[model samples]
Target: MAKKRKVDNLLALAVLSTIVERPMHRYEIAQTLCERGKDRDMAIKWGSLYTVVQNMAKAGFLEVVGSERDGARPERVIYRITDAGRVEMADWTRELLTTPEPEHHRFVAGLSILAVLPPAEVIELLGARLDALGRILEVARRELGDLTGTLPRLFLVESEFGLAMLEAEAAWTRSLRDELIEGSFDGLAQWRDWHDRGMRPSEVTASIERGVAEN
Candidate 1:
């Protein structure tokens, strides 16, 4: 299998994409990101944007074009994307789209240690998360609806993918909560007892067979 490479930070991708359209100063890159609502999707801090620009320049992904000064304002060095930048951006985008790499999410990590908490407590926490996901789904749906006529589907497809994933997660969470409440999950007793006994030596073999053995 080919190694999967992707952009770990959105600022790099955003800056490269922007400079490809036209050379921009550091401030302008930040401003354009905000204006296009790119910041909402990524953590594009204004303070760090300049540093990123400097680093990209050092890496030869970007080149300083010319400085512009308007009246009392300081001259800002404009930047344009280099051949390297274009290549990296394309590779990053393609990898992101075509490759399905596991991304870190808090809920999954929480689930890994979920047995540490009581089943009821776990259900409550997951319920809260499901409610929040419901609200986010509603907001995404409404926003997508509002944009339907005004913008192209290409612009909102990212949002659509996000919404679909959120919907699936919410549904799965709800089902899990229901199962816990109804004691319908297979091996619920064995699972609970395994955790309660703290994986005793005698029960280790059975627990392992049932797939509840904890490290």
Candidate 2:
């Protein structure tokens, strides 16, 4: 289970990581985060940065040291990470590294209701998805290869991990598609029968439930 924290938004963690170097105003923090590509690494809601920053300050994870103004622009509040913020950041990062949490994927969601689609159509869709994944992997592999010599492995590890995941998905999708095409999948017959008979969705679901109860 994930522990609840004072400021749960990942943007707060990015802010803490950035300002730990030095105090910066909100705009500076956002710019620094963008420059560092934190947005790509995390799910950052740009519009919520200000609210997340304010919430962290209110929770004592960040402290406002002073304010600064540039030209006729409105003053921006400078914020620095507090001791508590450092502790929280370290602990949160450690928790993330040490723990496994369930994450929902759209592909998994589609698979969950997959029986609703005819077996042939499902096979077609899976092939299309695999093709798309192949294209994505091709581009990612080229980019990662280009960056390998330019950047340290430490900096490129995330890209490598992403590529590995794409590869795994592509392999699994290809295997499943092959099973469907070969008529080797265990439930393929029943799946096709349901569609060929034009069984209504509710009737199909009820039949499935009865089968489960019997087993």
Candidate 3:
């Protein structure tokens, strides 16, 4: 049985949001996440995603829609959001937008993992991430530009702040990419033995139970 891990609320929210749009299988969810360009930081891992989907289904936030074989592979499970999932998504979205932002450890964890990637590959990855971020930033900029006099002054200020944040992130990414290309930093193994050692016995048991339940 696969071991269970605690699911991140943001990851759960992301998966639920995507499922709300349409039903999808695990691989499809991963592909959609890549397409959405939000997984660049390695904040979302396949194991974590699979775990979340299983837990959400168990929690009644999602329902299995159907299953079908993918070519020669085994049958794939597809899922769609339950009504409860939609309500949870809405509630989370509201909380996300209205509440003060919380410090996100996932970002740090991602960077730590990225530290293990080959220097050259890291540069390439960062370039791709920057390109994706650029596209998103452009769209946000255009949308905000169109809202010049349409939105209230307070909203305009908030929008500008959001854009500024994006710009700062882009700039930081560019700086990191340049540093990597220039060979300014040496690569290090991130998460060395932590992956296996970090799992608590209780958590491992929970994961095993979850996996057995699923199977």
Candidate 3 residue lDDT tens string, 61-108: 989989989699989999999998888888776766776754675546
**Model 1 accuracy (lDDT, Cα):** 0.81
lDDT of 3 at 3: 20
Output the better candidate (1/2) by TM-score: 2
The C-alpha TM-scores of every prediction are 0.83, 0.91, 0.49
The alpha-carbon deviation from the true structure for residue 85 of candidate 2, after best TM-score superposition, in angstroms, is: 0.6
Off by over 4 Å in 3: 1-8, 104-163, 166-215
Please report how far candidate 3 places residue 47 from its true position, in Å: 0.8
Model 2: per-residue Cα lDDT over 153-190, one tens digit each: 98778788889999999899999989999999998899
lDDT of 2: 0.88
Please, what is the whole-model Cα lDDT of each candidate in the order they appear? Answer: 0.81, 0.88, 0.74
Q: Pick the candidate with the highest TM-score.
A: 2
Error of 1 at 129 (Å): 1.0
Cα lDDT for residue 61, candidate 2: 91
After superposition, the stretches of candidate 2 with alpha carbons farther than 4 Å from their true spots are none
Candidate 3 C-alpha error for residue 97, in Å: 0.5
